[model samples]
Target: MSSMKKRMIKGMVRWSVLPADCILNSCIINIYKEGDYIPPHIDHHDFVRPFCIFMSKGNIIFGKEIYFVGLSEFRGSVTIPLPVGSVLILKGNGADLAKHYIPRVPWHKVLVTLRRMDHSKIPYGFQSDLELEELRLYEL
Candidate 1:
């Protein structure tokens, strides 16, 4: 594994948000600019719950039914601010039942998401990284 990825994993482990046995093998980096937004939707079942590390200030909306308020605005039952350096672990009803999305960002924002791939969803010919096979969080 790349040293950078190893460091990121270690940092996430230190947060103790995910289970000690959870093995995260994939990541998604999101970069949003002013007026950029993600529409509300539930996560696909292709992967386990995701852990998101926020790198900038923003708000994420979550609700059973998200309503559109304007071209770059939305309203949900709950709005959570994602402060810089905050880690959010999604699971249970928060992950399965509630739909979530980011409204248009006011400025530049970034997020790093980590997740474990479901065995059935592993792409053909993709090999698991041996180094990550036994990865576990350290006791915090």
Candidate 2:
């Protein structure tokens, strides 16, 4: 495994944001330029609860019902400023009921999202990573 990933997993487990046994087999990298915004929506159920690690400064808005003001803008119950390298773990009502979105970012931003795919939802022809399969925070 990459040293960076190792460090991140360690930090997450140490902070109790993620349990030691959580196996993250899927990853998505999102890069947003200035003026870019993401619409509010819940993550597909194909994967388990996902967590996002911010690579740049930005704000994420979350609410049970997200209202759009216009393209690139929105209104939500709360707006939270996420610092660089901050990790946001989504679960329960926050992950399944509430929708989340990013307002137009003032500058470039990058986010790394990690999740464990549901066993039955994994696409055919996909090969599992043995290393990641056995990875645990306690073993790091």
Candidate 3:
């Protein structure tokens, strides 16, 4: 697909080594300011197995393998403080089992995410189910 190829090229331009024909669903850009955070949760399975997540602006404290139990939660063994312009690719059960989240930041930050899709995994004739696609119609 042209869109998938375009997304792959975009990632390559950002210095990614992924194949140029990698089937990517789309690119998501998030801009978070002070006091903003990404709530702890596992990435959805709509996309493919590997998720390419990166940051382009400021630094962030990245938590991995988070375990939650009702009103309480526990941090796993890995706690990485990511630097600017860092790219992380997660595959297999990395996302399926472990949860990752970015805590509230004291400064502004920007994140670019590339999500791939397995055409076979996607439900057929469900394009209308995509809110983003509907929004794209108005160029919103």
Candidate 4:
């Protein structure tokens, strides 16, 4: 994970909104299996600082119906495909604004991988077998 942190610090990522006096705080590597998907959710917590996601495998399919305030809605959901070596950096605030989810209808399955940096450290990987409870929320 430290190696990944170093890579991110050296990588060039444009932020949608930049904060004052920001630093490379932390990183988490999320690997999702096939048919695994995240439901509609937001990372609007106060402690979650500006973060970025480097896609390792598969693609993140955003829901068309679900939306967050002050964020752009995808036209019938967008497929963010990433090859093995490619990377996708979401500007901290804008990335936070996007409401991410996997729709039950049509039964689409996608892996929305992320490497988030915050003021504090968060546990890496899925915390539970239940899809809805996979992402554990903690105060950072």
| TM-score of model 4 (CA atoms) | 0.48
Error of 3 at 48 (Å): 0.3
Reference-based lDDT, each prediction: 0.76, 0.77, 0.60, 0.44
Q: How well is each residue in 39-121 modelled by candidate 1, as lDDT tens digits?
A: 99888878787544455777888999989898867789999987777767888889889999888887888877778788888
**Tens digits of per-residue lDDT for model 4, 32-131:** 5544545566654533545545544455555435644323323335666656555554544345656655322223333233333343444466232232
Task: Give stretches of model 1 more than 4 Å off.
Answer: none
Q: Which residue pairs collide in model 2, if any?
A: none
Best by TM-score: 1
Candidate 1 versus the native: TM-score?
A: 0.86
Off by over 4 Å in 4: 13-21, 47-50, 67-76, 102-140
Q: Candidate 3 at 4: error in angstroms?
A: 14
Instruction: In angstroms, give how far residue 28 of model 4 lies from its true place.
Output: 1.9
All candidates: TM-score = 0.86, 0.85, 0.63, 0.48
Q: Which stretches of candidate 2 lie over 4 Å from their true place?
A: 1-3, 137-140
lDDT for position 34 in model 4: 48
Worst 10 residues of 1 by lDDT: 13-22
Report the backbone clash tally of model 3: 0
Instruction: Give per-residue lDDT, candidate 1, residue 53.
Output: 49
Given candidate 4, what's the lDDT at residue 65? 52
